[model samples]
Target: MPNRLALKRKSAYLAQLGRCYYCGLPMWQDDLDSFSRAHNIKPSQAKPLKCTAEHLEARQDGGLDTAQNIVAACWSCNQRRHKRKKAPAPDAYLDLVQQRVRKGRWHCAPLLTAFGALFAGHDSGGEATS
Candidate 1:
């Protein structure tokens, strides 16, 4: 049987439709090799591109480890978020992400651009922000 954390992660991933909550980047389930090669990192060290269970209210702040409090996030966003002295509330963070997206500050533009070729004609209106 899968562990609770693994189960939660899976649930969050599906709930978010495999997209990074912060950046809207598609977290491809089967792109480990491509992600590793692109970053020139070993698979073991490529967690940034992997989906992680992120706490809306960080555990250190007395957040419960419950489904309602968790969301799927990319490793990069998770790491960057934790670096801040205070974790922002989920709504605030999401607002910031939307603002960034509208300002053409997408964090994973290159990857999306590459994937764009294969997924031609399915634009997500990302370019309008630029």
Candidate 2:
């Protein structure tokens, strides 16, 4: 049987339509090997867009693993939030992420140009175009 947290994470991921809640980027749910294979990059380069379950209120802060508290996020976005000395609230972090996304500063240009174009199916700053 799958772990409860994994199930919740997958549920959140599916509900979010496979997009990271913070940066609105498509997240890869597979292992890094598959991600690298699919994207034609090394596993190290595939780390940023990996899917992860984020706790809105961190577990250290007494957050539960309930669906309401969990959200799907990209590895980069998830790591970005928690790496701060004092992590911002989810909504605040979300706003910050959106701003960065709109400005095309969230992920590097190369990642979006190659990895994102193949997986995310959108332009770096906005929607997919013909």
Candidate 3:
């Protein structure tokens, strides 16, 4: 059988329709090589767009790995959240990501522009607030 976390991640990915829950970008659930080829980016560049299981309530703070608590996020957004000294709540973080993604400040790689071309129709309006 597949690993539980992987299944959960896949479930979340599908639930989100392959979109990153945080940044609202397209993500690769598996096969970085394929993702790289599809996006025409290097493996290093593609790594940030891989799908990951995100905890709406962090595990460290007693959040369980149940489906209700899990959501799919991109590797970049996942890291961006945990990298903070104090990770913000999911809704708050979502707002922050929306702001940055709207202004195209969340991701700067040209590869993301190419990736966006593959899966268009994301409208992140408004400005990024401090």
Candidate with more favorable, higher TM-score: 1 or 3: 3
Which digits, one per residue and each the tens of the lDDT, describe model 1 over residues 38-126? 64556665555588888888888898779988888878777877888877777777777656655556455555454434233322212
State each model's CA lDDT, in order: 0.67, 0.79, 0.79
The candidate with the higher TM-score, 2 or 3, is 3
Write the residue-wise lDDT of candidate 2 on 1-130 in tens digits. 9899999999988887777888776678867787678767667766788889999999999999999999899989999999999999998998898777666687887665664433344432234547
Models 1 onward score TM values of: 0.71, 0.79, 0.84
- The residue pairs found clashing in candidate 3 are none
Point out the higher-scoring one by TM-score: 1 or 2. Answer: 2
Worst 10 residues of 3 by lDDT: 121-130
TM-score of 3: 0.84
Ranking by TM-score: 3, 2, 1
Candidate 1 — what's its lDDT?
Answer: 0.67
Runs in model 2 with CA error above 4 Å? 36-43, 114-130
Give the lDDT of residue 112 in candidate 2.
59
Q: Where in model 3 is the C-alpha error above 4 Å?
A: 116-130
